[model samples]
Every structure is written in structure tokens, then in C-alpha cells.
Target: MASLLDEILFETAGQGPPPSKDFYQFFITKNEVIWRWWKISGRTEFRGTPPEEIKMFHHNFLDDSRFQEQLAVVFGNKILEYTLGLCRRHFDYLERLPDQLLLKILSYMSIQDVGRLSQTSSRFKKICNSEEIWKLTVLGHCDMITEDMEMLAKAMGWKNIFFKFYYKNEHVNMASPAEEEDKANTASP
Candidate 1:
């Protein structure tokens, strides 16, 4: 089972182009066990809409519970509430949390949520660009920092912070054995 899943991931990762929204949608359902475990462990909540209706773009809808929680924080209750209301019928068991709680919820969302919520409104744009928020949300994660992420982080005034984290990783790899041997031999014997 693990090998089968690995083969699927390898195939997906090797796609000739960046995945389309539809591809991401299929990506979510491909790991049903993980989704189920997440639900049971309180990491996620499932909605009962027709599976056929689940398109990749629908990922932009109120799909990820963690993402919804973060959007509520970064965009404020008014917009968040309205957004929630939009998808409420489809996702009936969703939780309604207060804004105070919502702020902390930002930490729980995936970086994808940060990017998506940024497109929602100017208010969200502001919060998403907040240095403290980005720091808490994305730093220390494996090279998730990309050029676009840097642009977003810069808007939040954390470009240097992002670069520092990024280059540090590069430095570690560049300092590996072969480079170290050259550096050692080049120095005074």
C-alpha cells in the first residue's frame, strides 16, 4: 500500500508541468486514509458535498478547515463569516470560532492558505503580509521558501529574514565534504 502511494506521488511530482487546480483537487482525495486520520485526530473536518462536485478550484472554497480558520483571522470575522456562510450549506459540521481564537488559528494553516487568503481582500492582504504571522506560519519548514514566497515576505518587510533562512540552508549544503576538503587544503598547512 505504501509503495503504491509512493508510486502515485512520484508520478504526480514528476508531471511535466506545475499541477493544475484540478490536479491538486485529485491530490487531496488520493490519500483517503490520511484525510480520515486527520478528521479523527481533530486536524480536519470533512464536508458532505457530492464528491463529483469537488473540483480543484473548489480548493479555493471553504475546504481546508485550517485554511478557513486562518482566513477568519487574517480577514476578520465579517468577511470570514460571509465566506463561511457561502459554504455553510455544503459543510454543515463546521465550527464557528471567535476572532480572538481566529488569530491564533493562523498558525495552524498550511502556507497554501496564506497565499490563497491573500487574494481574498485588502484586509487579508495586510494580515497575510504581517511579519509576525508569516514568521509563525512558514519559517523552519523545509525549503518551502520560493521566489514568490520571498516577494510576499518582502511585502511584509521580512525579505531579509526569509533570505537569511533560505541562504543558511544553501550554505549548509555548499559546506559539504568536497567543499570542506578544498577549503582545508587551500588554507595554510
Candidate 2:
């Protein structure tokens, strides 16, 4: 399996009523979690008053309460909570798959299954509802498709085209109303 890595930078106010801004960088990889913090100081005399602190630990350390307490002490409760949520989000394997591969996999699924999967996440919804996927579905299941039909698909969208052809058992005329009017005018002349 491929390893995943994610990094996030955020500002937090630490124990100050006026909200002193500090930068926190949280890096989570397959095997470790690293966090670095830097306090922003605006005083001219204390230009480098506070320095950056970096800490790294094995993934297993997250299970220890001592580690959590240490992180809370250093990053404040809100930052720690936000960082933990990022860590959890990084492990979503299906969401990390490439769109092309996901579309290929979805092509194999039944339309009903794809519809249900679309409701699961925004990414899935976009992929499941995309024209490319619907086009592929139409091409795979339909016996005959023509250039004219493809032009119609482009105008009406692949999903609409697919349902119209697949369920209604009718051919869609690709000519626009302007083209039909022109044909009528030429025939009258």
C-alpha cells in the first residue's frame, strides 16, 4: 500500500485575551506525526523573542494520554483537537484514489449502486454524476451509437441522453431548431 502524507498550517491564539497570533504546522505521514509552532512577535526590540519548536513522534504515541497531554500543553486544546481531526481525515483510502481509477471502478458498478455511492461524499457525487462516466456507461451498455447521437449527447448531457435512449427506445434528432427552420425555408423556396 502507498503511504499518505498531509500538512496543515494554522494560526492560534495562545492564552492571551488580545489573541497573540502564532503559526502551527502539523505534518502527518504514514509512520509519524510532527508538529511545529512559532510565535509571532511584533516588538522591534524583541524581534526574535520567541523561536520555533518542532516535535515528532511515532504513530503509536497518539494512543498514549501522556502524549496527548504534552500536545495539549504545547499546541493548546483547540489546535490539538483540530490536528487530531486532520490525522483522522488523512486515512480515508477511497477518497485518496485517483479520479480516473475511481471512474473506471464505478463503470463496473450497476447504475443503482452508483446512485447510492454518489450520496456518500461530495467527491463520489461529482464522479458518479459526471458526463464522462455516463458516456462510458452508455457506450458500454448500448448496442448502437452514432456521430449524430454523440452531438445530441454533448448538448443534452450524457446522463439525459443515456436515459432517453436506454429507457425510451427512441432516437434523438441532433438538429437544432435553427437548423430545422433553415431546412423549412430552403424547402419552401
Candidate 3:
């Protein structure tokens, strides 16, 4: 799996924070870190200046406080910390997993567990809320899912179907024909 991450590990680009107009981009790959910048200013002197770029190996990047400060000034501590983690080769393997596989994995988890997992990361949140996963969940909870139900699921959404079908059926089943049977048995005794 490590070998699969030989390409770009992390990358982001955006304009600097408030009070600044410059744009910045950075890329972290297995071999090097590349930082690029474009000067954006209303002043005439800065208008024609070409974009600048810096390329450094991961080892050099760790010791380059100047670039680290520039990164913080452009983005914030969150991006800076993530960049540093990438430099340290701390890759997020789960994040790299294909969404299809994640959907399969999430389908096996309970609804409560899936809800908690969604809160952990944006990727998990997306997968947890996806229609495909919800379809799987509905199918698993139902003893027999018919073609008409699947068509209805597509029209109304699987999550809504699960709630309406599962919970409504549960509530309907709960209300009282069983009480009559129990009463009859007790009256016989």
C-alpha cells in the first residue's frame, strides 16, 4: 500500500488570508515539496511579475522555517500541521481508500456507529450519508425487499425509506393485538 502513494501525497492552493491578496499553492510528493506563489496586488510595480516557485526535498523542508512561516501566513495552522505531517511521511491511508470500498465497510456498521464515524471526518461523513450505503442498510434490515420497494426507494431516497418502513412497521406491530392473546391466556388460568 505504501508503494501506491509514490505520487502526490497532499496538495492545496488558495489565496492568502484576509488583508492579503497573494495566491499560494503547495504540493507534497514522495520525493519533494514544491511551493509556488503568485503576487497579486493593485500596485503597478507588482502587476507583471511572473509567478515564483520553490522545490525542496522533504528533509530540507523540515529545516526550512522560512517556508513554514510563509505557509502559515498564507493558510493557517491547520494546513501547516497537515503539511508537516506529510513531510514526516504520515500518510492517511484510510483517506486514500476508494469510496466504493468505504461504502461496503460502512454498510456493515450499525446506524449509531455510522453516525459517530461520520462525525470523525469529512470523507466518512460523505460516505455515511451517500445513497448507496443507505440502500445497503435498508436491504440488510428488511427481511425481504421487493422490486417495487426498490423503485420507491429510488424515488424517495433509501434513508427515508428505512425510517418510514422500519420504524413505522415497528410501531404498528407494537400496538396491541398481542395484548388480546396474553389476556385470553391469563383469563383461562
Candidate 4:
């Protein structure tokens, strides 16, 4: 019988398609992108070998506990995790993240991501609807938000829209008077 470690290695090795140009082009789904990126990054971690020296040993390669550290440095864990989750391809792992951390991560993704994540599951919908996350997720795209967007927005309710509108009015530029009108009004005054 194969040793436990051997089985693990074997299983991981066959879990993905070979890294060829054609395979990467057609077979690499959004879900697979994270899996492949994680594996490549994990291989990049062997201390003796530089990232370039580490090669594709097998289809499966990710085994890095410290991957988060590198990611945290580059994108910030808050954003990185959220971006991964928002991709809607890692729902299982994404759902398992701690609520606070997940919420922080959600804040870093775009409105479209938030909309997609809200459709993933009821639990995700609840978390995505929170004022803190929803506020940051939809920070500036009021006009782009449509009825489809409001499926998630319903969870947030009118109060959220009112608050966002209030903030937008207070802070964002709404309009500039026409130059001619301004000149005419100024002359009349």
C-alpha cells in the first residue's frame, strides 16, 4: 500500500491539468485559476531554491502555509481574501473564513463581485448585506446598480441606500452648472 504522505503527494499531483499553453488557455476556469496560482506560489516558497528555480513538479504543487504572508504583503489579506472569495469559484473555502475577516475581505472587492457573491448562498448573502461591507463594496456606483443588484440590496434595505445617497451627496460631485448659465446668472445678479 502507498504510504499516507505518498498518497497525498500522488493525489495532489494529479488534481490538475498539465501546465501547457493549450491546457492553460481552455481548461483553466476561474476556479482553477486560484488553485493553479496557489500551487505555483506554494512551489515558489522552497527556501533553498529561488522562485524561478522551483518548477512544475506535478499538476498539484501548493503546500505553503506562508502563502498568506506574501499575499498580505502584496495585496493585503483583507483585499486578497475578498478578491478570491468574490471570484465565486472558491465558495467552499470562502464560506469557511471567519466572519470578521471575511467581512473585511469583502470590503476590498468591487460592486460586481459583491453582487456575484451575494448569489452564492444564503449565508454569504447575509454577510454581504451588512452595512460595513455593502457600504464599501458599492461605494460609488449608484447608477450602475440595477434591479439584479438589489436582490442583494434588499437585504441591506432602503436605509442603506439613504445613507449611501446622503454620503454621495455630501462628498461626491453631483453637477457643475453650464458655463453660459453661470455667466448669465452672475451678470443678472
Candidate 5:
């Protein structure tokens, strides 16, 4: 079996507004984390002598308190908390899956389930709303798909075609704009 474990890391940098122009670069990896910081000195005499510093710590030796303290010192409490939250979601396997595979898997799901799954992520939302997925779904649910219907779906989109046929009601207006226009033109003087 393939190994499920994986390492994830990212880097972020920020610079404060002018007059207090502070710059920072943070890199986090599986085994180590590093932070570099510098501040622009507006002194004319010390033109090139800006204050700069760097701090690094191994992941193994980093306790929650120490990690939070260091992050707070460099990036403040808000960024520290946001980074921690992002770290928690780094190992999400589903989010890492290829789009083709995700679409194929979603094709097998019920329309309601697919709708719910789309709400989970932007990637999923795109796949779930795609014409290919909807075409697959329409094919799966329908026993007989006429060539004319297939042609119509290509023009109107599978999602629109599916909803039109599936939720059809006599009182509901189902005519395409082109058809409606044709009718109006034919009836007018």
C-alpha cells in the first residue's frame, strides 16, 4: 500500500505601512521553521544600517507555548492563530485529489449529495457544477436519451436540460427564449 503520510509547508511575508516599514518572511517546513524580520530606519546618518534579525526552531523541540510565543513576537496574535488554523487543514487528502478523479467520483453520487459536496470547497463547486458531470448524471438517471435531446443539451447545457426534464410541470414556463420569441413573432401583426 502507498504511504498516506505527507509533508506540507508554506511561506508568507508581510510589510507594515510607511513610517513603520517592517518586513518579515516566514517559512515553515516539516522539520524546521524560520522567521526573518527587518525594519527600515529613516535616519539620514545611519542610511544603510537598518535593524534585521532571524529566528529558527526545529519542529521536534517546539511546544505549543513556545511556538505561539515566537509566532506572536514576529507576526502578532491574529496571524499566529490564522497560521495555526491553516496548518490543521494542510493534511486534507480529499482537497488534494485530482479534479478528473473527483469529478468521476461525484458522477456516481446522487444529485442531492453532489449538491451538498459542492458547498465544501471551491474546487468541488466547480466540478459539481460542470457540464461534463451533469451530462454523466443525466445519462445515469435516464434510461433512454434521444439524439435530439443530446443535441439540445449540448446547446442548452446539461444542468439546464436535466432540471428542465426532471422538474417539469405544466404550469411552469419551460420554453427557451428562442422558442418564446418565435411564438411571439408568429402571433404578432
Candidate 6:
């Protein structure tokens, strides 16, 4: 586990794609990158050798090509870009929010706002069009969830159900959801 230095944004540890028996761990906190490793060898010279740790502030981490290459080898490019962004202060903090929390926050926004937010990024678009968010939207809009509604959602997906029953200014009338789906299907090309 990566030790928490204040608050960590990115962390991982492993003996990656391994043949050698050394363990490596690295973590990125808001202001620092800390890399730690332990030597695990049966050789007489390495016996009882202490674990090693290196800590560098964001700018120093960005400037160190050796450390950056080590990061690429262990963590890959996405994390490298993310850590670089952290160092540069181009903070993409919202993307780091847990999906559940982001979905909860999205559920509170009007559908129009969500539609606009979807255009801002692929991540937002995915969450905006996600089944979980649609389910929440449906539950929020309706006072009750009938057995028929549950069946309809299961069959057509929650987002489809929401669009079929309640998108735009349209609300469910005294019509069957299945019948509505049939009408919609037949009406489209």
C-alpha cells in the first residue's frame, strides 16, 4: 500500500511483469511524488539491506527524466500525463471524483444541464448517458416505480424508459409503456 502523505491522488504498487524479486511502490500526492522500493534477494550482500525511499516535489518530479522514465515503465502514460498535469497545476479534480459521487451530483442537475455537460467531455457524456444516472433520474421524476415500469426498464434500459416516458415536455399518459415503445419503434425509420 502507498503511504498517505497528506492526500494521495494516484497510487500503485507491485512486482510488475516480473522476473526479479524486487517490490516497487509509488504514489502521487497533491504536492509530491514519493517512490519507495525494497530489495528482496537471497544474496549475502543484499541481506538485511534497508528499504529505500525518494520524495520529490512536483516541479522536481517533472524535471527528472530518470524518474519520469521509471514512472512510464511502472505506471504507463495515462498516469504520467495525469501526474504531469498535477505538477503543472492543470488540475482535473472533477475527473478524479468517485463515479458514485459524480452520479449523485449529476442526479441533482436538470436534464438540460446534463445534456450540455455531456458535450464537455467523453467522461461526462458517458455518465450523463449511463444506466445508473437514468435510473436515478426516473426515480426522481416519478413518485412511484410500478412493476410494469421495472419490467419496461429491464427490457428497454432505464435511459430508454426515461426518454420514452418523460423526456422533453412529454410525460407518461394513460398508456402502456410497451405500447409506447411499439409506437416509438414503428414511428421511427
Best by lDDT: 3
Candidate 1, residue 187: Cα displacement in angstroms equals 42
**Over 4 Å off in model 2, which ranges?**
3-20, 41-53, 64-91, 167-189
| TM match of model 4 to true structure | 0.29
What overall lDDT goes with each candidate model? 0.46, 0.70, 0.87, 0.48, 0.70, 0.83
Better TM-score candidate (2, 5)? 2
Candidate 1 TM-score, true structure as reference? 0.27
Q: Give lDDT: candidate 2, residue 16.
A: 28
TM-score on alpha carbons, each prediction: 0.27, 0.59, 0.81, 0.29, 0.55, 0.60
lDDT of 1 at 35: 13
Model 6 misplaced stretches (Cα beyond 4 Å) = 1-6, 17-19, 98-101, 108-132, 140-189
Model 5 lDDT tens row, 1-189:
113334435577877544557777777655456666775666676566655655445433245577567677766787676566544544456766777888888888877799999998788889899988988777876787789988998799999987887646522767878999999999999
Across residues 1-189, which tens digit of lDDT does each residue of candidate 1 receive?
222223122111111122211111212222221111111122234433223322222335556777556444443466456554533432321123333344467668755686687787666666667776656555655546678777766665563565566546756756768878889999956
* lDDT, model 1: 0.46
The regions of model 4 sitting more than 4 angstroms off are 1-91, 135-159, 162-189
The sequence of per-residue lDDT tens digits that candidate 6 reaches over residues 32-141 is: 89999888888999999998999999989989999898877776877788788877877666776778989999999988899998998898999999989999999998
Q: Please give, for residues 15-118, the per-residue lDDT of candidate 2 as tens digits.
A: 32236565555555544566555666686775676655545544554566676676677567875775566545534567777899899999899887999999
Q: What ranges in model 1 sit over 4 Å off?
A: 1-100, 138-156, 163-189
Candidate 5 has which clashing residue pairs, if any?
none
User: Please, what are the lDDT tens digits per residue for candidate 4 over residues 67-129?
Assistant: 435334444556445534433333345555678888888777755687799998898898877
**Model 3 CA RMSD to the hidden true structure, in angstroms:** 6.5
TM-score winner between candidates 1 and 6? 6
Better of 3 and 4 by lDDT: 3
- Where does candidate 5 stray beyond 4 Å? 1-90, 143-150, 167-189
- How well does model 3 score by local distance difference test? 0.87
Q: If ranked by lDDT, best first, what sequence of candidates would result?
A: 3, 6, 5, 2, 4, 1
